[model samples]
Target: MGVCTSQNEAEKIENSEQDYQKLDFNRVSTYQKLENIANNIAAQQQIDTIFSSLIQRMIASRQSHILDMLEKMDSKKKQQFMTKLERIDFEFIDSLFHHCYKQDYPDVFSCNVVQSINSQEQNLDLIKKHKVGIVFLCGGRSSRLYDKLLSDIGLPSKKCVVQIMMERLKKVIMIASDNQEIVDYPIAIVLSDQNSEKFQMYLKGKRDFGFQSITFIFEKSLPVIDMKGQVVFEQENQAVMTPEGTGTIFLQLNSFINKFPNMEYIHFLGLDNLAGLPLDPQMLNLICKQKGDALCKVIETNSILDDRIFYFAKQFQTIKDQAKGIQENSQNLGQMCLNDLYLSVSFLNTLKQNHEKALKLNQRYHTIRRGNNIQFEKHIQDIIEVTDITILHQTDDFALLIDDARKAVIQLSNVHKRNLKLEGTQEKDLVEITPQMSYCRREDLKKIENATYPLII
Candidate 1:
């Protein structure tokens, strides 16, 4: 088309209808694929009807060539991926496009009155009584962590992220158990398609790190759309796709909750944060004290970088325009990052009732470009509601993927065995003590020469 600015662009458009196996589908071949799927359905083969409706819509939309591309694949691959085809519901898309975030909700409540703990033993006791569960979110592309292959980046002690996290979990269990009978806690990870298989294989080659078992949650893939609102293809058959954001965890939240029948607390940790505690007693005290539904843990800071974590704590309905900056909250949330969330299991169940309705009410998409095509994605923070929320100040929380990953590593080294300065706070005596540090930047670890002080991490 005249819109193509380059040769590859023109070729991509041409290849869209003529690639391997010739995507140039006639009306007959399109119908044949439909019949094949229908025959499978008639034979009582289980299939998600979502895909059937989606493929039919593609045909009606005059882009039936996408189906031709699939038909060209060998029957074996075709059968295996029959359901992976992303479903596009036009009505949903229309609604999302016209949807406005106007639902006003409550702000985060801080429990400064709840006193801090004096030891890990206290934290352990809270864990035992509450029957807590941990859900780690690692379902990301990890595009920035590497330049090429995943194996390219080196790690400390020749250990990968999974190894470090697993070892830490083992340490936590040992400490919490305190030589008594082992207490089993539920641990779930929401994995992206890119890292799911790799992590499983990586774990297989190594030991379980200490826990007897873990739960793996896989996310669904959604298609990338063009400026014209059409799904873009990545290959002859595969369309460019990304994992449904953090909200995808809602899909498996019930199962994870089921793991701990007596669960009173659930902590959702972003795998990147090395400073967050696996079984923090402070978190335990806050949730119980607040009697909250969905609670987010926020650090108190005025650092410029903290702005990235500031999200709309609650949606305001009846307001025609969305506010550009965050409003002042009980705490300085505008300059605070959402470290993690601690929820009462009962409260979490309330969110698990209706996935579609919850997503429509909470999730919002943002347009961005990846290589050659544009994409619409929702942020994890968008789905989370700060209900009966409590802002717990974590002095030692550290998350990766900062503006400068390398610099963040340097800061870790400096704070290895020392205290860090609070950027904007009157409480000068309070310090973040790391009972354990679970992750490291490979290159930064290499830079440190033989040092005398203890690198508690």
Candidate 2:
């Protein structure tokens, strides 16, 4: 009977312990959930504080639309946007408003713009005097050409535009070396971030097109702004962005000025145009003699030019007019303005001296249509608005522009046939002129004039 009583007492104690354990489990779970809810609320409050400050700044900067857009976004999107808003370059945006929206253009009228009077002998002499550097703007992609670097010459030679260009430079260097001592011309290529990796991979350890001095400036990208001036998102975390502009080339090159300390003038060339020779003696001479800050190559052509090409907004006066704007229609009746430029280092230095002004002045912003969003871009030619530029009016012979594959083939063939004196050759005829054979030397091409149809010289 005593044993039974003891067992009953132990059973009661065990049952009480089990009941306590069950109650403790419920207490812990409830506390855990409440703690998580409190933590989430705290996190949201912190996000609101930071983002509210950003929104206030946006409103202050006249970007209230951005705040409105933020208000309409769901919690997840709002969080994502706030994270990116922290990196928003408010200074660049403000500068855009300061120049573009306010119509605060550089005093282009004060700058001298004159037509070039060629003196080949004088120019050749000047070329020997001034140490010039070549800059290639390869930041743009050619969708129509099916290439990123515009490498294909649309020829059987298997030579690319860059190879041809470098060969031509070598030829020019050789010719210049005959008269005077010189160094291999410095080359600075400005490539966009998208193309830089692929291009650098192809060009790795190639000694930068076989030149001693080469500087690679990767163009920066700016965040894409929607039609409402809000940053556009490609994904939940990825923001859509575009390359800043050709203007950034100068901004970037300024930092690497020490690389080409001996270079007195910079000859800017677009990667696409093969007709214009780099640092052409004639243009170099004009830049040296006229004492002008900048020189622009202008062509008077009625032919349908590419949409990427620039146009003269007005007739050439004492002050050469800058381009009407970027992406003007081909039907616009005006001289075709090539972005190829010859600029004195002194002018670049002057820009550097006025760094703040230069930064704000050069960022010419325009809205590019991208579905519901807009992209902002700047042009190399916009520099003209800030400085005095000489307009070198070139003849139609200088206008072998390539906008598409067919046009490239036709234009390149025509140029080759005309130079080679291949009379019966049609535009569709595929001819290959190795850069080594002749770097656009008429006399050298004459030797291969009678070679053969579909010639590969």
Candidate 3:
């Protein structure tokens, strides 16, 4: 009789516990989730991160890309994104499409348009006096150009990219000096994994390029991982690889700047066009004199709608439809502008320290192709993301470069206005521009400073 009473009591206790749990099921689940989060936080606070294959891949694809993406996504979105991306095929696709370097850049960099300052000639002259150094981002893989066209005459000589770049810098020195004060400064070239060896060989004895010295800083190249997580092979022993973008610059800028202690400022330009000054003297002066760490020089450019006005917009206006202000603003790319950036050594160190976030400014990625052609690029225009940017629009004293119409084959040519100007692209370029689509040259600094022409940021 006592044993039966004990069993009944135990059953009652068990049933009571079950009834309590049923009554507060949602509360129990919430507590469990909170506990899991607490545990995750504790695990993350450990001295060293627990390494998984995915973490390893994140490190490989530039740690900042993963970190930035994480920061950008909220808790729920991050959980969903990460969980969905962890599967083998999905992770593989994510890795394959990682925004290492994309070129077409239909959607890239943007900034709040602020009121700009007048052209300061004193700034230009002061910066010019410091003997500023120049660096060109010239490390393209050349695979596209090669795939597009075969060797022309004899073993299809390496494209004249370096030659053309050197010629442009020579013009800059001439403008900055009466061919004298800004003489004998080294121009650093950031080479890709693909072009480092080739450039070293090509530039071996070439001093005709007019740079007192040319420095080659090679960027890292990582193998392309396919959807199966297997390395994509480019040739027998070589795996497919692409160059790390401007993040490379921010990471290595301090070290490179340290090497040239005499240089006060570094002028950076990408290889896509030779429109901006290799070293804009006024820009250097502004950067040197400003309380801020950096300066981004740009010019007023006609929007696509401005170009289309002659042909398409008139036709489209007949319809009752009108493009929204935001939509219309998208068409006006500040093409006449060449972002002539001037960075001080101190600022370079700051950029190096905060490189992960600063480089995020340049995180414009464009996915292309099934696998082989995914590309990523960071333009100098994106510098505003990392700094207190002071906007300087085109002035009459500044040279403006515009790509000429493709209707005819153009050998590189120059136009002399108030400032020296050069346009026309390489003979091997695939696309050409229309006259209506051209970037207009502005040689009206006097008018700009006098408020005759308002400065638009």
lDDT minimum window of 10 residues, candidate 3? 308-317
Q: For residues 1-457, write the lDDT of model 2, one tens digit per residue.
A: 0123322333322112232223332554433333333333325444454455454345434454454454456777778777777777765766554454345454332223666655543244434543787887777544345462445555676666766677766666666666344455577888886677766766664556666666788877877665445556664446666677676676578766667677788888885665657667667767777777888887776665653446453533454235532231223346667868877788888877886758766645554454665556777766665675555545443424454654665666666667777776666676655555443446655645345556776
lDDT of 2: 0.60
**How big is the positional error of residue 262 in model 1, measured in Å on the Cα after superposition?**
1.2
Q: Write the per-residue lDDT of candidate 1 for residues 1-457, one digit (tens) a residue.
A: 0122332432322223222233334755444444444333423333344456554445444445455555456655655556555445544443433342112222332222121222222345655553777877677666445411224122233334455556665566666666455445687877877678877776667754445577888876566556445567765466766665666566577887776788777777765554455656655665565455545655555454422234432221211113423233433333344647666776566655767746663554554455555544554554443233433333554644433444444444434423332233222122222334332322333333443232233
For each candidate, what is the lDDT? 0.50, 0.60, 0.43
Best-first order by lDDT:
2, 1, 3
| TM-score, one value per model | 0.63, 0.70, 0.51
Alpha carbon lDDT at 442, candidate 3: 43
True-structure Cα RMSD, model 1: 11.5
Clashes of 1: 6
Error of 2 at 111 (Å): 5.8
How well does candidate 2 match the true structure in TM-score terms? 0.70
Candidate 3 lDDT over 1-457, as tens digits, reads 0123322333322112232233332554433333332333324433112223343343333321333344544555655544533432324334445433222234433443322334454443533454467787666565534311112211112334455456556655655555674455657887776777766776674654545566777776544555423445443223456664554565566666776677766777754443344665556655555444555554453444211001111111111113312122233344344435555566656665785856575454333343434433434445554554433334433222223222112211222212222223233432211122122234431221222111121
* TM-score, prediction 3: 0.51
What's the CA error at residue 332 for candidate 3, in Å?
5.1
